[model samples]
Target: MVSPHSASDNDNENGPGVSLVEIEPGVAVVMGDRPLEALGLPAEFDCEVSPFQLMPPGDIQNLADKISLATGGLNLAAQGVHGVVSARGLVRLAPETMKAMKSGLQPLTSGGKNLGVLVGKGGKIAHQIRWVPATGAAATNVLAALGSAAVTLALQSQLASVSKKLDKNLKETQSIAHTIYGDRWYDLMGLYKNAMRAFREAQDLGVVNQHTFSLVAADLSNLEGKRGSFRDNLRRHVAALNTDQKQQLDYIRENSNQILADVQAVLVAEETWRCFHLLRTAHISCDTTMDPALKEKQLAHMVEQVKREYAQSMDEVSRITLELERMCSLIAILPGKRSISFFGSNNTRNDGEVARMAATLAKTVSEMRNRVHAIPEKPEPKVKALRRNVPDDVLVLLQYLLPEDEPLLALAEATCYGEVFSGSDVYLGITLTQFFVADKDKMSQEGIIDKMYPLADVRYVRFQEQGSPMLEMFTKTDNLSLLFNWWAASGPKLADVRRIRDLFATVMNIPEEEYRDDSLFAEAHQAFAAAKTGMKELPRKSRHSAG
Candidate 1:
């Protein structure tokens, strides 16, 4: 704080660590040797190596970004240079940078060029004495005057040459990109012409994914933003507009894609959608256990499910599968769907509405069928492509249930047991149109059990085909006294075989054996539930028996 001549004190008094050596007369290396000469730059100038703690952090960061970018570009040249060194090495030897020059020039010697400097000059000189030869005299000249105006001029000259070369080669680039991009960007582009071309080529070569696509997109965006600002500035200087000049201003932009098409908009509004949907219409088609072979285990399971519903028609199996698929699909669509169906339909039944309802149900049915058939185990080579478009949860569940071509048994034991769909007029007796009979409505699909039937004597069954049992039996078309005694004889309990078994027994004064088949579905699921181990044992013990 007190002494001017002392180095430490002088720095703090002025700017910390600032010195005459670092504090030059506002020096910068411009892009001309003549400009450098006018400035009378030393053979080497002192660059302040700011300590991270001392420097204004913002300034340091900006400088770091430029240095990093320049270093990367320089490193590209050194890759070909025989004695190429790292940025740290070049910076290390920065003081005696001339001595360190040959190493950094190695890549150029390998038939490359750099108008940029040997980075990390001091560190490079100290550690590795890379004795690389030059690619050409021009490369040597640029390195010799790096960070000075002469070096800048060399870069500028290189840039100008590059610009000219680019102008000359633009047609070739466009040709290559066109070949690569093909039809994806046929009517769209900018640098996307090049970028999308590259992306599609990568895809063709089996590399199209989010990461690579994003990086290329980011590069093109940055390049375009800069180019756009520069183009705007140039347009400001034009006093008179010629067609060619105006064309130059509009060159790339005239073909650029200004916006993405709204997918729904395109689908509903345009010809492209008809083409896409038409194309879609045409195509209609893991794990673990080292103890058993994967393929054999899977085949065995498929054979087993096939055997269970034996003698049933394929159409019946299809109906069960179709129902489960439809149900799952309805649940899937319900998550994001709300509709006008809820508004007017306090069970609405107008003909126009009914037709629309049929159409919706048809679509729902089709999607369900498609999904069931689209099982993961069963997908053929081409089915992979079509099924690739299914909803995620459906795909995940299918993968779990139908692994390795195993056939699935879509059993809906209790997914909807206690559930009820409201409204009485829903499908009380099916539908009758003037010319033909239309039948079954949405409530019927939702399990609105609507029937009953009488049996021998006073005892009878509450048949599903009957409209309502409770409303009927109370009017006592009596001799009902015998059935009340029958119910008391074999009392109902939760342990009963089937609800149907218990109900028939109650209404008919008949034993379970006489009333229903013991191997009915109700009995089978109860067996499976009780016997936690071994599916093989239960079916035998609970076999359909007559006693």
Candidate 2:
């Protein structure tokens, strides 16, 4: 063991006011009771020291022997120091090495002093070990370092826990997807998992700094984007399933909720860590600067940056939280439909009371569609498009059909010919807020009949029979039925019809299976069966009947 008191005696041999003691063969532990700078070393923590073992522990008196014996000894001790510091506590060392170190540490404790250790090749004993009895800035730096390390480790542990949760959630999602979609969604799920894989790889690199943190954040952002698309596809696919198939995949909604929760946890951890990282960098920069004026300026700039980042990060967090909440709300209400009218409501109308539609002039419908196409794409575009596209005659007629104050989202025109309407052509003009019709024979303003039912008000839609296919929508106000055959129309394609159907279903939250082509026949058959069951009598033969 060594101390400042023994330095004078060993000065001539070691160096002026320097003392070193060899506690093991070829290895020395330098102990001091004075500040490192007072014991002849730089008064800073950031400097590097040259290796000392290759040189003599003393200036002369068997210096050659000392140098030969201590060769590579400093390197081993340096490695041990690094391991202990990184571990943040005592670490198990080789039995022989521990015994030697314990012996070297023995005499230093009687004074009740704090000890600090530094290690590097080629430095004076004081350069390798510091006695930090001085208080103030040095002590604060040490404490700050310790605090930052602890917080970093805590964030890492939380992140690991969140990652494990994410893994479990991902597995659950995969199982549900396989059950519902039969492995067709595996490629889609893989896209998100691959993004997660990149995040994990970036994290595994020792020591997360600002750069690595940014990379991981970007990976998570990418995963979020992919997840959004995946969710849309999942919703559409589920909506297209039949009742029995939908029942089989009921667990999907719950699994999706779990996945979203896991993702939220990940993002919170990442953003919190990034905040801490930036603050730590700022502190380090402040501490290393020499000029007081410059340091203050640097600090003020850092504070502004930190405040800006915090605000931005909080905004991001709020956005994500709101998104997750909205998604959860949507999933919670899935597999449910709007109420159907045939169930007999107080507001139900008799067949005679149901209003019939009138046909619009062909020239009017054509002009309206052209106007719709020419509307600009922004600033209440949909509303503007509808208003600008409505022909003067149609608009004047709508005032009598709907409330003048009601808002319209869009306008569309379709030509339909059906045998049920006596093989007459029907012109259907649809708006998000209402549908107006004009029949082929009466193409005048007096012939047009408006069914001003809002899409939002529609609770259910029934598609009945292929011979004269028609859509009957039951809304809060009234039921409106349309006989449509776009195949006979020159303008709208099947895609356009589908677009309108999808828009209606989305607004009504009606499942795709409820309105699909193949399923419509079954739906119509069920409706007929229900009606037949409720019917009081069969039709009787008239005198004009051939039978």
Candidate 3:
């Protein structure tokens, strides 16, 4: 157990018999003080500090939460008061003294004025002091007096409970890792150490407040969550191996390395997620009423952190994508009957484990793909506010293009301007009755020109591949067959084109089977196959044509 007394815990006569001795970095015992006046209590109202460990666990967390909330309103450091007060003792003070203390801590109450002692307290003091207890009508005031240390103590207690579960998880996880990786276990061990270093460092700092403690707790929890996955993956791999195949050191090493790399990638993803979570929490905790400059700085920090985490997450997604592609290429070469096999069919086949790993990889990739798609399209200087793939400017225009009674279903914009189509911008809008493509540019002073095509008239949607694929909507109208190109000019990215196409299809209620791979292309493919068998020369279209 950590000692409850600090090196400076010397008793002096002038002050109360006690000095603060830290039992935890953020928690301390008040050995003695001169009199109530030195610690901000009335001169006649003498009180002694008692350890809060005697309190129930639920009460500790509740008290810590209250203290954390109260610190936002009061600053204990400015008052030159740094010792703890027991919740039990606060009620014991002389009624007059208790009244004075409550009045002093009144800022902790909603609409209460700032206490003379709390005016100078800010983030600095919020992190420094330890002892405080809140109860009764003055509970908020008392909690404020406890300082952030009370929250830290509560957090540490929570960590102790979580740690017990982690210990068991890690022991089992380590044994499985050792069994599979053999001498290579050292690599995973290093990752485990890296994961744990944060918690150890926080404990050593001896002054972790709730936010700081929360960050370390996230790390521990992430590690614990990963333990089961790692164990299951490695165990599945080993269980699928026969006695003879297990001896194939080269294959074993390769597979082991791949698993380790995957785990490391996942850890990076978890860390990124943790950062995003922290940023969100920071945003919530930020004092809107605080100094304008400080709030600006806080907001800027959060924005920068969000950008960094996004970039890191994208990098991980790319790495995972490459791995998936490679797996696909390997699967493609297998015999039809053995296509379900993973790693390979013959000697290398570990169907049970490798197939399961493939499924896991597929799930991970699907989730990452969804996240990537959910990201808002980046805006160009010329265009603005492309939120959720729909530009604000386009949505505004949608109102003018569609009938007043028509309800908008979905909207998306593509940067298909000026190449194939004479426009500075393009937008696709969908409604229950129909979908339309609107083209607008600076030269056209008149409003946007749009062609509305009924949903029932739509025959097919397909990509016309040139330098960049252009989405074409084929429609039949009263003996006329027409193709309307949803111009994906040279400017629109492949991703942008796909997003527009998918959104359009979804709003039009077109089945994925029809739009993704339309039957029209299939008919053409069959016709070409028959023509080839008859030795007829089918002219290959030019590479640069838009239509």
In terms of TM-score, the best-performing candidate is: 3
Q: Number of clashes in every candidate structure?
A: 32, 12, 12
Tens digits of per-residue lDDT, candidate 1, 1-547, equal 0011222212222211111111011122122111112222233432322122212334333433333343332332222223322221110012233334433422212113222221233333111111222234433443332233222222222222222323343343333334433543243233424443443343243333344344344443444443344233323322211233224223212211110011111111111211111111111001123343443344344433332322132233233323333233332232333222221234222323322332333333223222223333322211111101333533333332222343322110111111122222211111111000011232223211222123222244332212211111211133211111111123231112124223334444443444665568988888877776667666767775522
Q: Rate the local accuracy (lDDT) of all candidates.
A: 0.26, 0.36, 0.39
Global local distance difference test of model 2: 0.36
Q: Write the per-residue lDDT of candidate 2 for residues 38-62, one digit (tens) a residue.
A: 4443322111111221112232223
The lDDT-based order of candidates, best leading, equals 3, 2, 1
Candidate 1 Cα lDDT to native: 0.26
lDDT (0-100) at residue 244 of candidate 3?
Answer: 30
lDDT value, residue 55 of candidate 2: 15
TM-score pick, better of 2 and 3: 3
Candidate 2 is scored at a TM of 0.20
> What is the model-wide C-alpha lDDT for candidate 3?
0.39
TM-score of each model, paired residue for residue:
0.15, 0.20, 0.25
* Ten-residue stretch with the least lDDT total in model 3: 1-10
Rank the candidate models, highest TM-score first: 3, 2, 1
User: Regarding TM-score, does 1 or 2 come out ahead?
Assistant: 2
